[model samples]
Target: MPIDALVYLSMTVFSLPIAGIRMFKISSLSLSIGMSAIAAAALTACGGSDDGAASTREVALEFVAVAGHTPVQCGTLVSGLGTGSAPAQVKDLRFYISNVALLQANGTETPLTLSANDNWNLTAGANQITLIDLENATGACSNGTPATNAVIRGTVPAGNYVGIKLTMGVPFALNHTLYSDVTTAKPPLDIGAMAWSWQSGRKFTKIELTDPEGATGSWTAKTFAVHLGSTGCVGNPATGETVQCKAPNRMEARLTSFNPDQQKIALDVQALVAGNDVTKNLGGAAGCMSGGTDPECAGVFRAMAIDWKADGTGTGLPIAAGASQTIFRPIAR
Candidate 1:
């Protein structure tokens, strides 16, 4: 029974001796025994007894952005990045994470039940996504909003979790929604800067940096943007057709040594662009946009451990087993 109902019952039983002692003529010893039995039953039903069911506890997975050893912030210059060791100003930094799970010593995976708030975190059926926005609107992050979120809050079964696994992209079902209609759309998905109309999906990652030198080349663009999203998408939901993409471009990270209480996930910008020259864009857009023919995506994909063919027909695919991602790593808090 509910706690309120139990309390009412207990009150009525206790008042019987004073108000209905003559009417019922019940013995004190019998009434005492009945009350004890009722209390025992309620305790068992409420699991106050020794039960083997595991309890769950709230957990917060923190994330941060860095360039080598320097912390990344909007308008702040992070040097020693890219192949040329070029210094660039932070512009934008945001990404989505989903399908979080905690790993046990024996490789058992337990899904982390997300705390949905209709804002940064949302859970629809089997899909749970959280937006990690590290950039505030201040400084060079003028295109972003003032609000920022970097922690993915959820609940996990109470146990010793030694590892963590998560996907760095929004699920396809929630990705193709009408993001432009912010009046009805939910937050995180409603962000205009993360939406891509061309692919009819949201940008999984928006990491942009401004090249200070603006080196002269075929592409003299000052901003080196890395927008990762699904490519070669066929069909449109707006037209009442099912949407699908050839390349999902979702990156999964599995850290076998992560401890949520003592460590944080660090997105190293220097490692992300270490193989490419930040001063210039070799071909296809200002920077890699998850294009098949883009030369700049090779380094980014390699760092993420995603496969990409150089023949211009490359579909962004997850690398083979045993390979690991370099962009996201576990660092001491």
Candidate 2:
């Protein structure tokens, strides 16, 4: 019952004469106590909160793939992509992200509590990950799946968020696992193309582009691939042991002024390959594979603002400290 109705009923019952109370075989004090108990129970059942606390609000941070100012699609040609201004078709564009946070004006960061789902988002212990799939299984992106996810959905404490921060990789605890193990691997983690079995971890970023002419010069097979993952990994997950990596090539990006409501983060293919000729591969894998000594990785790492060393133990400088990642930037929606 409503509190007002309960109050009125209690007053009416309390005003009853001693004869009415005697008929009920209860004293006036006892009847008053019973009414008070009922009122307390009603209040408890109504979900009333007297304390003032900020409620959480749902946020869907948007993202997009672009080549310079033009939007990127599987079959469509992205012009002005590399140092050679190469026009190529996107073969694959997928990446994993974690540790999403919204920044406050006072420089405080509030973690985005991801909404757990079977497909895109998963939270295991202290790790929260979301896969951002920008390519559909069309044209050159046939290796990818038909489904695509371009937004990171989560909840954050209600406040005026001024910026956004995220890490472009899966967490260590969840990264090193068997991709073929169906019971253990989940949606985003179950993808075979993103798995690196030799390293016992995932390719944090799998970005590939192909020349339309099918040319095979320094760029053999007419494809330039940039696969980012932990390199120089030690230990074996197959033996049920923890894995350690010398260079966890996870890229971190932070936008000091981002409005999630009105802007979307854009990953520019042009910016990623601007420092190198995509048509040429000097050494190592066909393209950059997070190898510290790979000539192709220098340009990619420089674009990502990650310090690179030839010895494979290049986790030295902190790029995120200066917030200098050039591949991802906020654009008006």
Candidate 3:
């Protein structure tokens, strides 16, 4: 008989709750069943399992943003731009990146478990993202935030990861929450300057540069701001309602052949603003404002490997192409 059957048979034989009476009632059937139950319990206590639950180990990954070889800073003049444009001084550079993952050698991606950093990261429940702030309003960058965040940290599965992958904007559901209404809104999202008044959404990437030499002749420092965000947003911001976006201009960055332990991921601003005119502003906006018809975006979006004018609609969401390369690259630490 089975162990369970022995337990049932012993229950019948033992008339009272006396311990010795139950022991005396043990027959061959009872011994086999009772021993089987005890053996199973021992196995459970010993942590014996056929499933591979203990294989994954905790891993930490760090992300960094840079300009050329140097770390990005305010008031620093960056030269070599599009069509002989003048040297530009960076005023501010803040952006949001989300959905971090580690690309394995077998072409499988392991999603990271993000721990929120009070200064740099924001995580409320399932939503976790990084706010990279690189300047303050001390010198020429008077409009920038003083709190700088260059390094973003997250935990991943311990293994030989071939690459790192991340998305460059807030998800559509959490993108349009108004600052005033959202008490939980953190740092970069809470900043008023990053909020778009027309669309009521956060700027995915804000890179502001000014020419220090007065070469533009109009202002002492002509502005070149690339505010990447969703356009054609429809809804109200006052009631903490998330608006529907026509374009969720979120760019995906995938750096292949990257080892987080040995290599550092670089977000080169030089490659970002490459082949883009800083001095000229053809439209009302000084730089590419994630607008479909903006002439400035043609070069800016192209260099970033984004399909700007897709489907002949003059507008499209940021699509990730495996063949096209982006500014985010892996370099030795």
Q: Give the whole-model CA lDDT for all candidates, comma-separated.
A: 0.81, 0.81, 0.69
Error of 1 at 52 (Å): 11
Q: Taking the tens digit of each residue's C-alpha lDDT, what string does model 2 give over 1-333?
A: 755555555554334557535533445566667777776676555543235333666899998999888999898878987788877889999999888999999889899999876688888888889989999989888889899999999999776789998888888888988887876677679888889854568988889998766554344447889888887788888888779887877788888899988999999988888877887778888778888798888888888888787656578234765277788999999
Model 1, residue 323: distance off in Å is: 3.3
Model 2 earns a TM-score of: 0.82
* Model 1 regions lying over 4 Å from their true place: 1-54, 182-185, 213-219
After superposition, candidate 2 runs with Cα above 4 Å error: 1-54, 215-221, 311-313, 316-318
Enumerate residue pairs that collide in model 1.
none
Residue pairs in candidate 3 whose N, alpha carbon or C atoms collide under 3 angstroms? 3-33
Worst 10 residues of 3 by lDDT: 47-56
Indicate the residue-level lDDT of 17 in model 1. 48
User: Compared to the true structure, candidate 1 yields what TM-score?
Assistant: 0.81
User: If the candidates were sorted by their TM-score against the true structure, best first, what order would they fall in?
Assistant: 2, 1, 3
Q: Where is the poorest 10-residue window by lDDT in model 1?
A: 211-220
Top model number, TM-score? 2
lDDT of 3 by residue, 1-333 (tens): 665665666665544576555444556665666777787777655545334344344555545656667666676666655565456677777888877888887878887776655756777667778787766775567877676776666666546678877787887656777655546566546777778764567888888877776454544228788888877678786675557766666777777788767877777777777766677787747888878777777777775666676233544455554236457888887
